[model samples]
Target: MALQFDATEYAARLDRLTARMRDDKLDALLLFAQESMYWLTGYDTFGYCFFQTLVVKVDGSMTLLTRSADLRQARHTSTIDDIVIWVDRVNADPTMDLKNMLSEMDLLGCRIGVEYDTHGMTGRVARLLDNQLTSFCQIIDASYLVGELRLVKSPAEIAHAERAAALADDALDAALPLIHAGGNEAAILAAMQGAVFAGGGDYPANEFIIGSGPDALLCRYKAGRRTLDAADQLTLEWAGVSAHYHAAMMRTVVIGEPSARHRELYAACFEAIKAIETVLRPGYTFGDVFETHARIMDERGLTRHRLNACGYSLGARFSPSWMEQQMFHTGNPQPILPDMTLFVHMIIMDSERNTAMTLGHTYLTTAEAPRALSRHPLDLIVK
Candidate 1:
């Protein structure tokens, strides 16, 4: 909370990316992805959940086109040089304003890169430009290009992320004292979120996981009506954003004392994460990272519990981080590099209860090792 962000540093970062875009034959990169927008401009727009669209010029000066009502707050928080106003009149066809802006910029047929995968640019908007502009513009996939640039963290970004991680750590510490065998999972989640807010952090995504008993096996478990039991295990994974930088931390805790089975699953996951962390260094292949975990699981005879890759790149913003492993999910095979941040979680699910026992943390990659940005207690906590 005591940290201050340098907007000039962010502007310079975007300017560098824009320079690369120009060299790559991009006339002007049209970015509509929320994460991409935040990366380019150091502002978090939860308002995107309503009127969602932001445009970025290759030269780094940008404008966010959204509902007229949102423009005021967006302006207040925006660190960019310009703001384009898009009035959403009732039954007035808001797309017209967007079409007009594109035409004014003369972006047609510019070999533009569209972050369509994340932008969600609809067919209607695509057709609108095609018909109104009277010119054909080749829309290229720009997700990876921008994602690669964001993979490495600047010192400032790492600092903010470290602070965010610390906030999460404290929040977990505050919430853990309130956990009990008879506590409701929902109540525990509320306390955790309250701690986050009290730390002056905004829960932008509002995605927190709290599961216990048989309900923890689900991968994306939501806090529900379930109550913690004396023998039940609980998982709490949460994230917070500071100055558009995101920090994620997750841990497993037990109500009262843990059972023998809980200890086994927890220990195995911790050992697996430790095994995965030991082999992480620059020049290591993504394949090698995966094999490290594979070897550990095999050695422990726990191969059946292997869930996903050991970890992935992370950033303060929503762009990709450096640990690009392609085997699992939508990832790249890119190697880890210095200044790259990674979010890693090793989990072993309880088949009987349909819940997961998770251990998660963030790492800042260095030439020798991935530095631990997360300082949360790695061992399973017992209330």
Candidate 2:
């Protein structure tokens, strides 16, 4: 099996999960999140687009119900042995098969936890399961149960995150030189991805966010690309993924002499990130970090340019987004813990000036202080 971690590690994760299940009075957990399944049993596969589920009992036993296409995939990538392939045909119902599986495990009348918020559990499929099993079992939304458990990284997981961070730095190093006047955003993006793969890294959960000119002010990735002008700003947000673990980084580069506004905004962004680092230690709530960013930006009169949230937790994730559940935003009560990997981005987008200044990097929370995973300098790069 191509398990990402050792058998002992997988076993320990199962123990932790089952313990949580017992504490919640859950007889079984219906896992649909790829990240949760992978974290628990190293079951790595992209078959989540279709209907798939992993039934994990409180006794630490697991059975994967997937289409036949993923039967070998589950075997090769995960420690799960009892795999059941559900056929797709006209009038075929996988949920019925799932119900039978639960009945066989004596879970038909038990309290079951379901990952209702995951991409794998679509509304249609969830509704089908609910309609079929509501007469037999009690279904509860346990969406963030496993996600909460995964917030803090284990020692081995931290090692993978650190390796990913190094590759992220290397990607930035290789891509920076390509950000010259008249450079192509597509070409720079290609170089960035190539650098990560050349360093034995895997594709990130999401596409690399790369943009130039006015598009630089945007945060998310778009479909098209543009060419850099003689005097323009370019923003990049990408990650280095190793064994599906992610360490993301963001930077805004100037292709020509930066304006005075750019200098001032970049300075505020740098100071905001520095302030964030100080409060990222254990005992601090995720909200405290966002407060720090807000206070710094507010003090600089850049509130209009600031983002609603500063950062979020990072880990092995699937597509649609790389962000995890725990986020650095106002009113969030989640406390920072040691071994947690966070990506804090000080984003300052001045639409009035049509300029963007963003500086972000991943950090590993420690007892003393948060340690930066990337070795790159946080200064604004002006070419």
Residue 28's C-alpha lDDT in candidate 1?
Answer: 68
lDDT string for model 1 (10-70, tens) is 6677887788888888876766666666666655555654545666667565666776666
Off by over 4 Å in 2: none
- How far out, in Å, is residue 174 in model 2? 1.0
- Stretches > 4 Å off in candidate 1: 1-4, 50-52, 90-96, 119-134, 298-304, 317-331, 353-355
Let me know the TM-score candidate 1 reaches against the reference structure.
0.85
Which ten residues in a row are the worst by lDDT in model 2? 275-284
Q: Note the residue pairs that clash in candidate 1.
A: 109-137, 216-355, 216-356, 217-354, 217-355, 245-316, 246-316
Q: In model 1, state the lDDT of residue 137.
A: 66
lDDT of 2 by residue, 1-383 (tens): 89889998998888889999999999999999999999988888789999999999999888999999999899899999899989989988899999998999899789999999988888899889998899989998999999999999999999999999999999998898888988999889999999999999998999999989999999999999898999999999999999999999999999899999999999999888888888898788999999999999999999988999999999999887789988899989898889999999988999998989999999999987999999998877988
By TM-score, the best candidate is 2
Q: What are the RMSD figures for all models against the true structure?
A: 3.7, 1.0
In candidate 1, position 332 carries an lDDT of: 37
The TM-score values for the models, in the order shown, are: 0.85, 0.98
